[model samples]
Target: MQSIRDRLEIILSRLANRADEKVYTKLYSEAARAAADAADARQKAGVGLGLLDGAIVSIKDLFDVAGEPTAAGSLMLASAAPASRDAAVVRRLRQAGAVILGKTNMTEFAFTAIGDNLHYGTPGNAVDASLIPGGSSSGAAVAVAEGSSAISIGSDTGGSVRIPASLNGVVGFKPTARRVPLAGAFPLSMTLDSIGPLARSVTECALADAVMAGEDSAFLQPIALAGLRVGIPRGVLFDETQAEVASAFEGSIRKLEQSGARVADLAVDDLIAEMRAATKRGTIASMEGAEVHEDWLAAGASVPVDPHVSGPLSRALAIPASVYIRTIRRRTELAASMDERLASVDVLALPTTPMVAPSIAAMTGDEALRDKTEGLLLRNTQAANQFDLCAISLPMPGMILPAGLMLVARRGHDRHLLGIAAAVETLLGR
Candidate 1:
């Protein structure tokens, strides 16, 4: 096998233009080389070889890696004390024999779907430099797309992983909330936060997720497409979808149908409207997020929250306790309702995002436009989070610019979802 150290060197060399301080805020060169050396030594001794042995993996900045401050893509936490030990998942990754590349950048506190960060630079989309990479897992997705890592770990709350993966044309998996430990990562929404992997393929994500969960590699069984039922909601998710994105999504539906899968367009507006109402009622992330940052902000650990993030947090801080509690209850009710609605389908299908990646210029020039675009991007993927569903984003076919076809399954069915995704991926080709 190729030496792990050599692979790290090769990966780093490709990152020469990965958008400075954005995709990767830190590079654990010496530490990674040391780990790589150990892996190679173990190989020679015929021991210490695990599933991810010698693989290079990049971590989202939110993950706590011992001895490094988890800045979470903000300068506010830059001076925070180093972590005492690796986050549970990071420890698991190491145990799986992977080389920890470094911490990747993200939206400040992972508060936004858009990747822009005032403190740390934004990682430009690899598919289109002018575009804003989908985030708060922006750097994690870009790192994989840029070939800087074989796989990257990221946190998903409200479509963070799926949005970025869709925009970057890579596979993004958001397992059930409790599928992986959340002990070490900085919190965005305690209720919705999930840890998952973004990689070139579904099998890779499944393998990484298994290791992170401290479980044996899942046996991926492919479900035949002939009898598979893919549900495409007729409204809400498709509302305001750009022409190009809609075309790509429709094309994928056609392909699946031709491949023998039965595509059903269901009247899902009620379920979707309920999700939107939940957001309007109150955001769980913003509510819990305010609590999480209250101390730090009061002490001035984070002096000035980014405008985009501050708007929501400030409102959340003022949210009456009753409102927050009500919203939580409403969210649970909505999740149950949505899951129940999926009884007739094998999986839910929709565009991963409402549009192709928009130029960062368009977003930067008009504040209102930026807000609007970001909201649209989150429109589709956030449903899965709201419904507490396990979801994956796969690239759609014949796209000059990348678009994604998302597949969502009921929560707690992550492994089975991955298997279904793998079957779809195969139908679409690698």
Candidate 2:
């Protein structure tokens, strides 16, 4: 209780005094302080709520906070009326006694992983102010990286959480699509959207995920590194991957091997190619995302959605409904093939992002360059959502550009995945 109160005070001070415009879109100052005080009282009365009691956390703007408009980093919804109820995740977190500091800024409509929202202003990477912070969960990751919160709850549709965490050198976990409730989170791709956490370590993520899932926060049990089977699936995921990310990932693998883990160079290229082909050159998020926003975009709301964002959503309108259905059916059939391919391996390991953070200046205002860069950033992490797998990105040491080594497991293996990640975090720190 005391430790939590101390951290809350520091975070409050930082949020209050910091001059960074992009760090947060809103801060629940009075509510957060009151929550902290109540938690302290519970501790004094010997009636704690749960493990996260008094823990300071941040929510993405897209999550419903009763009576507050879910701007979702968009100008379109900026003046919309407040929500009638709290998002399910928000309620669960509150039940577990979390102190939500405020809603952080994000990519408008959670559209791009590039993290630029000309309307709300994207967060600058904590590692490098000039570079772009990975998004649509940009500010959520930044809050933790910049010391405004201990944990952040964000939605991952196409590497939103992990991409930002990777670029900012923090741990981001995307649980299986079904693990966390998404009832009140604004949808990007309802089928692919999953809620998760970004924090300094896997242990913290494990605890936060549990709370989000309505479970008691428990300490993560570290798995044995020796004899752990790790697979690296071959595909377009590696094409154009930066040497910096490649070197760091490869080096991390060697360390794991030395610690007795079995690293397999798997031949899953055909599986990956078939899956990508099934989607017919466009992403699932693009198709589903268009349906969610087309009505509003057509109504002339004066939204600040960038060309990069509007282009894809507009293009998705042309996709035949049959195309989406056929693609989904094909992907569903291919899930068995993916399952068979991974049956032998305990987990898959890869770079969280194909490249390090690119300067905002380089991609900003250049539509072609932004499109190319966005694809590169989302290339690796997007696979997790498509394949319905639980994934996590752990910060890899020894790099000028921030790098993250991502670990993936079969869907519904979230707990096991976190345990493995905790073990890897320990080994990497060694």
Give the TM-scores of the predictions, in the order they appear: 0.96, 0.96
Residues 1-430 of candidate 1: C-alpha lDDT, one tens digit per residue:
6687888888777665544556898999888989899999988898975788888899999999888788888778888899999999999999888999988889999989889888877899989877889899999999899888889999998999999999999999999898899999999888999999999999999889999887876678788889798888877678898888889888788888998989888777887777667668568888889898887644554365687887778768877888888888888998888788888898988999988888888888898998888889888888888889999999887888787889999988888889989988988874
The residue-by-residue lDDT of candidate 2 on 136-216, one tens digit each, is: 899988888888888999999989999999999999999989789998899989889999999998988998999888776
Best by lDDT: 2
Q: How good is model 2 by TM-score?
A: 0.96
The clash count of every prediction, one per candidate, is: 0, 0
Shift of residue 345 alpha carbon in model 1, Å: 1.2
User: Against the true structure, what is every candidate's RMSD?
Assistant: 1.7, 1.6
Residue 341's lDDT in candidate 2:
79
CA RMSD (A), model 2:
1.6
